[model samples]
Target chain A: MRLSEEQYELIEAYLNNELSAADRTSFENELQADSELMAEVTLQRDLRLGFRAIGISQALDKARAQYNANRRVEAVPADPSSKPMPVTRPLSTWQYWAAAASVVVVLGVGYFVFQQTTEQPTDLAYNETFVPVDELTKEFPRGLAPNTRQQFLDILKEYEAGNYSTAIDQLKTLPADRQTVHYRNFFLGLSYLANKQPTEAIPLLQKALATPSVALRQKAEWFLALAYVKNGQKEKALPTLKRISADKAHPFNLLAQRVLQKIN
Target chain B: MAIRPLPTFLSDQELYDALKRRDDRAYQYLYAESFPSFRHWMLTHNGSEMDAEDAFQKGMLSFLLNVETGKYQFQASTQVTTVLFEYCKRVWLTELKSARVRTKAAMPDSVDSMDTGNVVEDLERLEVVNTVQKSLSQLKDECRKLIEWFYIEELSLREIAERLGMKETSVKSKRYDCAEKLKGFYAQNAKKMGL
Candidate 1:
């Protein structure tokens, strides 16, 4: 008997152990002389058995979260002694971002060590004080800590102080894996523009725009948007700036919003 | 307090409930449970263990932020793992784009011989997915919920029809017709996406 769709379904149910006694007997009779029906039954049964073999959700209780066993003190560093981070970057590229990345790496390594060396206070109740002063946090944007993120900020200081040449040179000595590579590129683009070289600045700024990290991507694009304006290529920069301002959630949206107004 | 054990095959609503209840433990359980397969997927894509770890972290952060910021409105029908994996993978791509750290890591060749059944099989699966989504969009308040309960949550079709005061036969037919519509939709969209 050539199996009809119903007969095929009946046989499938039987082979799947889904049929009752009456249905199974009917399916067996239905399969008589229909070797094709028998073949399908075998194929489906084998495939289902294969699915069960791979197994699913068998290790729920046993698997451990990665951060659990690796214990280190989780406390803010006390007077980190203003040390810089070290970054181990294999140098091959001559891109300005690559140069900036090296400086950022040193600062990151310094932060990592400082974070590691911090003493964990036993008493959480000992202090809950909140005091703010411009002098207290007046460190960064002033001095570039040898192995810290401040090094990039330090370059910014040089740029802000009308010493673009020194800032450009200072960036090269940075470690290879610094977080500030984002800003380094941003500022490099800006500094190059400041020194009357928008063409050299364009690629560096473009790197910032294409940054993968959302915060950095937004920041880079925000500045690239500005850099476009500064280059007198207002047509080119306006669209880019519009993108940053359009992202209402970004921290720089307000800044981008203001800048867009001036350009338009 | 009697703590509800986090369900293994948790329905999306259950996950949303757990999430809404601010149960960190449940989220941790879900992450630990799914990590191995997800890690394997990363490896298959030529991602190092470090890459997997970083990707998972970013995914979790995005998930939590979306939840806390009320961006991820509860979709009662969607699987938590599906949402998590999708979000995680997007973050991974974003990370790869942004990190700019070049690695020689290469992805394995694409699976060439996925056991595609009858030409109708691919179309069938595609249709089911599409019909489900489309009907989901067109359905009224209750019909949508009923279908989700039937398929996604694996509820008995008889129970779904009965609960909604509909004929069981009609429910089955509607479901079939919906699936067929989806299959046709798949046939149409597949061409568009160049699948």
Candidate 2:
């Protein structure tokens, strides 16, 4: 039965216990008399329950995200290490060109020497298994607003089409709300890695790891580890990779174990 | 990054009030304070980290539903986390019991301590909620947004109307239409799944 506005309001008030004592008694009488009204009340009650479930679930998800964000900040520091560096002082005009020439010659010979040497463990391991995950469809939020969802899908299309830079540009334009923040950070991090911007990918991937979805966290962890390896931050990558390797049931566990063995 | 300080303890009423308001910080506080111990307990009880996560999610949904529906009364001296842990622990124990049953093995001693009341019914209710969630995901974008804004988010009709650039009457009508569509989808899925 199509409920009128007054009927809907009355039902809502009754459910919320906003009905006056006399009105509540009358409503209860009507409920007993009319089975249809009782059925409507039941439906309304169930719907409210379902909605509340969704709301709380969403809140829990956001809380998870907050937890993840906290973990990321704690785990990743601005200066991961404090290695001393040689300070460059100002030089004369002739000294600048001469220094540049010498640096170029040294780099040329260094490159040749490095090429002839045995591959570094991280380099070999990363090269053997590191491939950017390009599947963006699954990362799309199922409950985003229509316009935002379409825009995000379009951005995903860009990422899938190998337009990493274009995708990143579009991703930067999207505001990071509660619904989109996790995906935004994760895919954007991957996009940065795809574009060979590992430094840029680090923080985003770290933040993405803080998401409450276990699947998303696994994906972020795997990619984040690879990002560290690509950036030559072996010290930071090893712990994450070890965690993945230890989880025998994780999707990335076998690959992580292989990477661990090769790198070690 | 500034770290949010979590309380070492909170009364049941305080925790329930925070949860009812959907405070993320309160949730973070809850997790920080209790989950580690809960996870440790799970790990010691033949449960993996993944099992702990899954169990926690199930238990949390049940707990939050009860909190929202006023089914969980705040006791004067109860530790909220203790109650939550019991609910979650029971869920894991129940799962283990069922698995053992499936294998025709003897019941484990862990299941012996559980005083079963309405846990099975609660689990079944959560399963229905899960089914509803799936149906909601399958809803058309417009209908989903309409239903979500009006019901889930609890936005006023006038507010939604202004946001959508529609008259309040039209928004109300659309909300009803969307609700009906949602109900149709939910009903079909529930029937198919025997929810």
Candidate 3:
């Protein structure tokens, strides 16, 4: 049965439990009398449930991947230290002096080892935390022509494929306006960052912060901070990092806090 | 040794809001805060790391979907992590219970009396969704994208029209047509799969 727009909305409201008690009772009565209406409701409910299930499944996969990536970063050291934790032992007079000399040499190596471990966390945080945005997973921006939409998708596909240079060239072909402006700036900035052109990434990310979508703004702000860090502008990154750290709800909150601790 | 920082928010509501928006930071923060303890519980309960991981993911997806759909009403007294652990625990328990039933093994004493009806039903629904999702892949690229944008992403007709450079009226009709095509494909696939 082909339902009219109003009928579809009414059925959706009923199925979603948004209907008033009186309306719900009336709808139940209608359902009892009309087999076609009952069938249509069932179809609508199943379709919705199906979409929701699939959406959550995709999200779960992404979350699992993110969790695994984070776990891998913290689990093992790239460079193992030569000396394990020190243990105390009683020593003879001659052995004491010999041990003292060895201690000095050990201290020298200790400092180098300390430097290696300390340096790793910051770089590791950047590398492990930055999962390249999947373009197909992202909702395409509204209002492009069919060709433009295809073009945007092509650029996104290239970006996902690590062809940042080609993606950047194609991104530049897309016109910017109120609707397309944020997306162009954001994706272009991401492409630049992935291409190791953080200097070029900064301005676009800053512009992307002006987007109406809070999610897009949050993404832009995050990459903007990372861009500053990448460009060796740690001082500029500080404010954004602090802001993210302060906002407990931000997706980057914990990571921002970690990065801030390392650099500080 | 560097200590991992905890998420900044003090309340579950704030964290839930971030998750609903699909914020990666929130996802990561929740992973750090909740997964370890849940994994530990799983290990003690005769579950392996892989089992824990799978349960955690499924539980998280279920919880988030409920939150998104307004099926989960927040309780001021319940910590978000605590609730999440319960969800993960239930998923594992349900799996264990079914495994025992299938193998004719003794039921473990650790199995609680909590209901597994919703979790089982949701899993079954997920199977149907998976089947239909594969069917969606068989659709022409334009029709698939159109239906996905409108239904799955819930984009407004105006926004969709803007994206495709079509008039709102045309986009509205296109949405209907695309939905019908998707339903046709889904019905055929569902019958084939006996779903």
Candidate 4:
């Protein structure tokens, strides 16, 4: 049986130990009488255990990285001789040139290694290319119930104000009728991207690409490509970005070309 | 992100408490401190550096899971490092026995005497964890994030509301919806995995 919202909240409160002693005692008495409620509680408890396990695993991964990085730092050998060597004799001109060339080569190699290790061009490109679409509600979808339409308009205010997490939460609550589906998906996808969740953004943006409006489809395709890049799926992004770059009339043509150069 | 220095605990109890709390710094400190000796033990036990690292990670994960779940309780007599080392050693020994490497070298009597818990049961528990992880990944973005933020990150409803720009009441309702969706995914996954 589908639990009412109140029932769901009650279960959560019990699971979280947020209920009072008297209330918990009464709830336990209710569970004793209801096998279904007992089973529901067990399932909720298991789900929470699973969630906590996932959190521990993620924390362990971070710790592992930190431990490894610290080891690498410690493993680097300290130079034993800090004092400059006294010149025993004047160096020959060829020897001086050879020493100068060696210094130049060493500096060049160090700089190359540093650049290779530290530079992330695709990340730079994504940061540069992904400006959030302004005024998301400008073409507010028609035929939404007045209340629903008003709710969406309010959500757009959060979106525009850079409160993407809030926008995403409210967006998920909106009723996605046939007319509003694509619009909701597009804005939801945009909010996900703005919140640095490219993995979440990618699928929704792909769905948004099927929107009937050519202009919205173009925007969706552009954002989809950017999401792919941000998500480390550059290969998936290439075809769409190439298509955009090939069409000078496409609004994102210049931006796509620039991103392609950086990623490549 | 900047790497913070590993935190120090004044006593084994403090370290155990931190581990039970799932403190990231405690995990890091334990990992860094224990690995060198564990690596040495592994090298002497017919294992390579990679094998040592693998065994240690698996062991650490299993042991910490037990601690968080209250299967392993703190004891004043047992140093945290000693217990951690023992766990890693047991992991390597289990791997060796499974691979039949014990035939190549005499099994250490010391290790054989220790109470090494059931390896098969440990693996089964880890499998459940894997199933949960897979189910979580399959959830839609909104539901996954909401669940993670609420349950994993332990964010309060009011804190999540502030971040989402919603009222606390709305956030609470949304969390319930997301949680229900997660339960749906988990049930399907559990069935598929025969859990």
Candidate 5:
């Protein structure tokens, strides 16, 4: 859409940290190519310099609050951070994994939504989980009496449709039981792992592994080990895999064997 | 090259300039002053605190993007506060609108006050920014240091991770997490300050 004068002016105003993302990015390109527009924008930027700019510093309050001093994932000194650098930095143990989950939540969706540095692992692994969260069932599947098999199918639909954020939120509200619980736990952990936030994923996978059901036990153990690996604890992971691989009949035993080879 | 302070471009006018110059003081001043109000506005309608923060970080990113791309301009004497407020509001509103969560609109009750001489408003906005900066000082040592390192130092993801002894990929994700934590500090303090 050809931007009108006010639209152009509004965009320029926004550029001085005045415009929001929903608006700025949509028109950022158009402003770049227009020179007269560019001059007008520069003038506005100059005048506003003395004025304290606007931004959603609050929205990111989560990031600012808790810290992983031990992990050092966020401890990089800012020197030319404009470029996304390669990182093989160890994903540390998660202490206070609050709600800013978008980073690793979507990793299993297969997009690499965020880039990585070379200091980190060269090969990225994709594993999804599902767990029974009460709140998730309300938004996901309205009824639970439809039989365990069908409930699992419906829950799978939610994961496949990419409603993980919703799934995670809802799962938080649900009790840890019910037949579909395992599935929900599995995928929820997977979503976190996918987003590359294994610290968050580890607990959920640990919970999934805790379930007494043999069906879930092996799978949960497999992911929990992977979660440990992602968090840079190959030592802890080695045992988890070794225990699972001992169960020759377990479905995930084969997967566990492959992982044990890499870490061991 | 008399090392004349590079004339500020229209786009590179806000925190990005100080950020590019690795000026932690200016970044702290700007971040502490503005984050709470943005957080308050973002939390409208039972939205998670993270939603507001995500929008906030995204807004800052867009601001930097515009400045870096050389598309930012200043003409009207609009304070940076108004611009950023408008930006964060628009971004949050778009999210709300897209989610189709109907509620009280985010439009301001009055902006006609802006018609007054721009210079006066600039002073008022600067005052607001200063209030935020003071609030930032209230943050604990780790939080404060982290913020200073990030926006001010402009460190790369890998560099920050390595220095901090964190995984690089984890650091990128954690920056957002830390930002959300900082917002919590701003909100709690704003409540006490009654701002």
Candidate 6:
């Protein structure tokens, strides 16, 4: 009772609501007549749910990481001297000399390693850090007019399909009203970056960081830092990257740290 | 170091909508905002911090699954945080009941009044998710990516074709093949898990 390709496609279309009214009615009638078909539909639905759960589970992991990081930051003593100090005998002179010697050895090794390694290209760092946004996961902000929403969705389709040049063109033509400016800027910046025009991406991404949505702002910050690196403005990227890397609760903290290591 | 502020929702409905949309900020906000009080509650209820964390993860997963699958609906009377806390509390209670740790503390009368829906059934459903996840992992790299992009990412055939540098027709055929492979794996895993 294995389904053929057409049957599979029809079932998928039915589930996705992509079938026409007549087709849907016919499919429903067929499903009612066939128990196996109904079971297949149920299985497909469950499988889709499972896939979605995986995505949700990943999001939960991110949330957990952020919570733990915040807790760690909160756990740090605000004033080091406020806590009772452990009573210990003073370090012997030989113990002090040994500690000093260890520091000198470590410094020597670090200096030698620094001298031997050439600075890696920013392209390497950019490539390592820059993951394009999954356009499908994003929803258009509320308050968009129907026509404007359709236009934006079409642009996202292009972007998702890797038609970045077309997406860029479509994005530019969208009206940058207060309601739509942030959405337009973010996607356009992403499009330009994906299309290898990081110079054009920088300003748009910078504007996108002004988005009222915390999630969108976090995304913009990460991409803007990458845009700086890709545009050979490493010095400009430093402050943002350093801020992100130092903040354990930031979603992109580890990635920012890796980028810093590669570039520096 | 200044901690980053959690995202604020205008209302419980807004938070619920954000959760349904799988917004990362909402998840983080929920976790951060709910945890301190939940941890304190756990500590006072004969549970350790580790127990609290485990219950929180399992409870959050179940609550979120219910939210996404329309098993739970938003009610203006009940705040999202309250619902989340109840779910975690039920998870802890279920664990305590199973481990015979309930005798250590006198159970509060309020615990029996809370309508935390069947935690055991919710966990059973999660096992199905685990089976699907394991089956997905067993797929070959190409098939796995194709299945993920198509199903999870919801990318279209044409979009996937472009990314893979294949013709749309070929991509369609490949998708069918990959999906069949996934079904085979899923069936085996489901049987193994007695689902």
Predicted model with the maximum DockQ = 4
In candidate 6, which residue pairs clash?
none
Q: What is the lDDT for A144 in model 4?
A: 66
Candidate of highest TM-score: 2
- Which tens-of-lDDT digit does each residue in A80-147 have in candidate 2? 44221111111111110000000101000000000111232111111111121223555666688999
RMSD of each: 21.3, 16.6, 18.8, 15.7, 22.7, 18.6
For model 3 chain A, the run of ten residues with the poorest summed lDDT:
A106-115
Residue-pair clash count for candidate 6: 0
lDDT: the better of candidates 5 and 6 = 6
lDDT of 3 by residue, B23-114 (tens): 65576677767877886788789875445655776677778777777788777899878888888888889878887787799885657465
Regions of candidate 4 where Cα sits further than 4 Å from its true position: A77-264, B1-6, B46-50, B95-122
Give the per-residue lDDT digits (tens) of candidate 6, residues B1-195.
Answer: 123456789999999999998997899889877876777788889875445555766678888988988899999999999999988888888656545443465445565554545886876776677667667756775887788788877799999999999999999999998888888888887877688
- Per residue, candidate 4 scores C-alpha lDDT tens digits across B56-102 of 76677778878988888999999988988987788778766655453
Residue A210 alpha-carbon offset, candidate 5, angstroms: 3.7
| DockQ scores of the candidates | 0.04, 0.17, 0.15, 0.21, 0.02, 0.14
Please state the error at residue A200 of candidate 1 in Å: 47
- Tell me the deviation in Å of residue A9 in model 2: 4.1
List ranges where model 3 is wrong by over 4 Å.
A1-28, A59-264, B1-7, B20-23, B112-114, B189-195
Best by lDDT: 6
Q: Report lDDT (Cα) of residue A94, candidate 3.
A: 12
Lowest lDDT block of 10, candidate 5 chain A: A97-106
Number of the candidate with higher DockQ, 4 or 6: 4
lDDT of 5 at B173: 59
Candidate 6 Cα errors over 4 Å, as ranges: A73-264, B1-3, B98-117
Compared with the true structure, what per-residue lDDT tens digits does model 3 show for residues A144-198?
7787777787776565444555677788878886768888898888776654456
Pairs that clash in candidate 2: A68-A210
- Tens-digit per-residue lDDT, B1-195, candidate 1: 111233443466776667544454555456645565666777777564445554554455445435533668877678777777866665555434334334445422332232223222323332233222332334443444554455444477798788768899777666555433433443344455444
